[model samples]
Structure formats: structure tokens, C-alpha cells
Target: MKNNTYYRLTLLAVILSLSVTAATFGQGRQNRLTNSPREGYWVIESQPRQKSVALFYNDDNQLIYKEVLSKKRLNIKQAKTQESLKAVLEQALRQWAVSQKTGGNPIQNDQQWLAAELN
Candidate 1:
């Protein structure tokens, strides 16, 4: 019984240590964009064919936050122009920041924002 408990405990510790190490290394190796068009506002982190991950920054270029934007999340039916897409992303980020300041309560319906953005 004693040997079984020790083995289980050792296994748990190893698993936990590996998880922490992976998380730390992953954060240290973030893939930041080198030539984002919206450099002043946000940096594109990852852009899959359909979805995009972005990291917003303040005026001093300090990382403010991150968000993932996709057509499904925004309820968009068609493709958006580049300028319009940037505007929508900026607006979503601002709304998210405000929501965070206000106790993380969702501010409005996502569909509402999408409709307003699309139009």
C-alpha cells in the first residue's frame, strides 16, 4: 500500500511539473506578428484561413490583451473588406476592455454588434 501511494504521488508530481514547464515555455515563445497593418492598435498573432487571433497593445506598444475573432463569433454571413474588418476588430476589443472594467459582464448581444458592424 505504501509503495503504491508513493508511486502515484510521484507520477502526479511529474505530470504537474511538466504541465507548468510547458505553459511557461509556451508563453515565452509567443508568435508576434512582424508586419501587421494595424500596428498601432493590435498585432496579428495567428491567422488561420477562417479565424484570426490578435493581441492588442497600448500606445506605448505594451501588450494590453488578446482575442480570437471569427465569422461564427461575429455572426457574419459574407466576407468583409479589409478596412471594415479592422474597424470591427478594434470595436470588439474596445467593447471587451470596457466589459472587463465593468466586472466582466457581457455588455450586449454579439449579434447586435455584428449587425451594426456589417452595416
Candidate 2:
């Protein structure tokens, strides 16, 4: 009975450790786009391959502000480290915001829309 209890405890510990390790490395060191929402600040809604859709809510979820962003014009690449990719995304966002103010449609230019992404 003592030996059986010891083995069971050991097995549980090993399984737990393995799960933790796997969870830690699950992203696999890629510079993937993470849409970590900034609560009570601002939110960007990305629409892929479309002009505009009639949204139901179309408003911030009780947050500060919200805006629609076409992914066809922002951070449309996967060839950089996470930090650099974040910088590029920020620049693209700024450009998109500007375009919105000037009443210039974003979906016009389809090839690498953001100037920052071209750099």
C-alpha cells in the first residue's frame, strides 16, 4: 500500500510539470498578432477582406472609445520579431486613424497597404 501511494504521487507530479512546460511553450516563439484588449482605453475592430458591415452594437462595449480597422491595411505581415512587429503595428494603426479623418477609403490599395509595413 505504501509503494502504491508513492508511485501515484510521483505520477501526478510528473504530469503536472509536463503540462506546465507545454503551456509555457505553447505559442512556439512566433511573432503572432495578439489582440490584447486595452480596457477603458481604445479598441480596434479588424475586418478582413471587406469594405464595411452593418454591426449590431457598433459601439464600444462600455469602454472609452472604439474604431473599425481593416486588417487589409494593418500589420499584414509575419516577418519580424515580436517587439518589431508591435512597433510596425502601432505605426500602421496611426496611419489608419489618420486616413479615417481625411475621408480616404482604406480598401483602395490592396498591396501592403500600410507604409510602415513596407519598411
Candidate 3:
């Protein structure tokens, strides 16, 4: 009887350990877009009338981090390893700056203006 009880207890312990391990592993495998990465891009919502842009990069799974460039030239670099996204963001900013300098709005409502500037 004692040997049977011992065997049952061992089996229970093994099952419990496996359950715990499986739970932990499942949690670790969450969607990358939901869990912020140590490096990459993420998109966040902005306030109304706030001209903001977010550049994101993922490890083909989750967004690691982001670079948020605001309208007031607020350069906030949140990710460490998204150089390509950063370059594209900077290019967009440069284009906007040039449009402002040239007294032309890059994002105007007029279709002609947009087509000319984009082209």
C-alpha cells in the first residue's frame, strides 16, 4: 500500500511540474506585437491635431521598440536597433521640412498638390 502511494505521489509531482513548465513556456510565446521587444518598432496613438509619426521594426514577429517624431521636432528614439525605420522616418521629416520651407504643404487636401509633391 505504501509503495503504491509513493508511486502515485511521484506521478502527481511530475504532472504538476510539467503543467507549470508548460504554462510558463506558453506565456513566453506571446504575440510580439503585444509584448514590447528589447529592440524594434511599435506604433502608438497620438492626440488630436498632433502630427506625429511612429516608425516600427519587428524581428519578423513582434515590435521591439519605436521612434516617435513629433511635429515640434521632438525626437524620441525608443528603440536601439531599428536603423532602417529611423532612416525612413528622418527622410519623411526632411521632406516635410523642405515642404514647409518652400511654402508648400506636403499633406494638403488638394489632390493636385499631393500628387505634385509626392511625385
Candidate 4:
């Protein structure tokens, strides 16, 4: 009887641990930006110490631009043109919004803007 009880307790503990871990993982993803409208210009506020990447898109869902605004160096090798810069800015803004909702510190600098201009 004692062995059976011990086994059951162990199983319960394992189940509880798994549940807690799953919950945390879900929360982490929720903290990041997910599916959001890829239209217009967005303003992104990133953590003072981290680099931010924003993405901009046109009405047809084409990747028009991308930008990486960072306090540190951001190695963007494929970004060219204003469109690409706009795409990057939009994505960064979405991420910043999500981060803010999830308890991340507000962006300290107000220098980032992502605009998706129609061409």
C-alpha cells in the first residue's frame, strides 16, 4: 500500500510540473508579438538595452521594408530601400507593443518609427 501511494504521489508531482511548465511556455509566447495587421506605420519602443527589429508590408502582403534600430550594432545584410526599412519598423512596433503588455519595461527612446508607404 505504501509503495502504491508513493508511486501515485510521484505521478501527481510529475503532472503538476508539466502543467506549470506548459503554462509558462504559453505565457512567454503571449509576451511576444503574434499575428497582427501588417498595414500603416507603427512606432516601436524597445528596451533600452536591447536591439529592436521592425517589419513593414504593403497591401498585397509583400515585404516592403525592414529596419533594425539598436543601441548596439544590428547586422542587417539584406535590407535596402525605404520599403524594406518600413517593414522592419512595423514588426518592431508590434513586438514592442506585445512586450509592453507582458510587463516589459517601456521603451526609453522615442526615436523609432515604421511607416508602410503605398507604392
How good is model 1 by TM-score? 0.30
Per-residue lDDT tens digits for candidate 4, residues 9-62, read 999999999999999999887754353344555333355588665544445454
Question: Against the correct fold, how does model 3 do in TM-score?
Answer: 0.33
My TM-score estimates for the predictions, one after another, are: 0.30, 0.34, 0.33, 0.40
Pick the winner on lDDT between candidates 1 and 2.
Answer: 1
> Per-residue CA lDDT of candidate 1, range 26-119, in tens?
7666632322334346455444457655555545575545555574233223447344445655665576568768877653433344335556
Clashes of 3: 5
Off by over 4 Å in 3: 31-33, 36-79, 82-119
Ranking by TM-score: 4, 2, 3, 1
TM-score of 4: 0.40
Query: Which pairs clash (backbone N, Cα, C closer than 3 Å) in model 1?
Result: none
RMSD of each: 14.3, 9.3, 12.6, 13.7
Q: For residues 1-119, what per-residue lDDT tens digits would candidate 2 score against the true structure?
A: 99999999999999999999887787653323254212212222446575321111112442211233343333424544233334434544554557679977552222332323335
Give Cα-based local distance difference scores for all models.
0.55, 0.42, 0.47, 0.54
Best candidate, TM-score: 4
By the TM-score metric, which is better: model 2 or model 4?
4
**Cα error of candidate 3 at position 56, Å:** 8.2
Residue-pair clashes per prediction, in order, are: 0, 0, 5, 17
User: What's the distance in Å from true for residue 60, model 2?
Assistant: 21
Q: Name the regions of candidate 1 deviating beyond 4 angstroms.
A: 1-80, 107-109
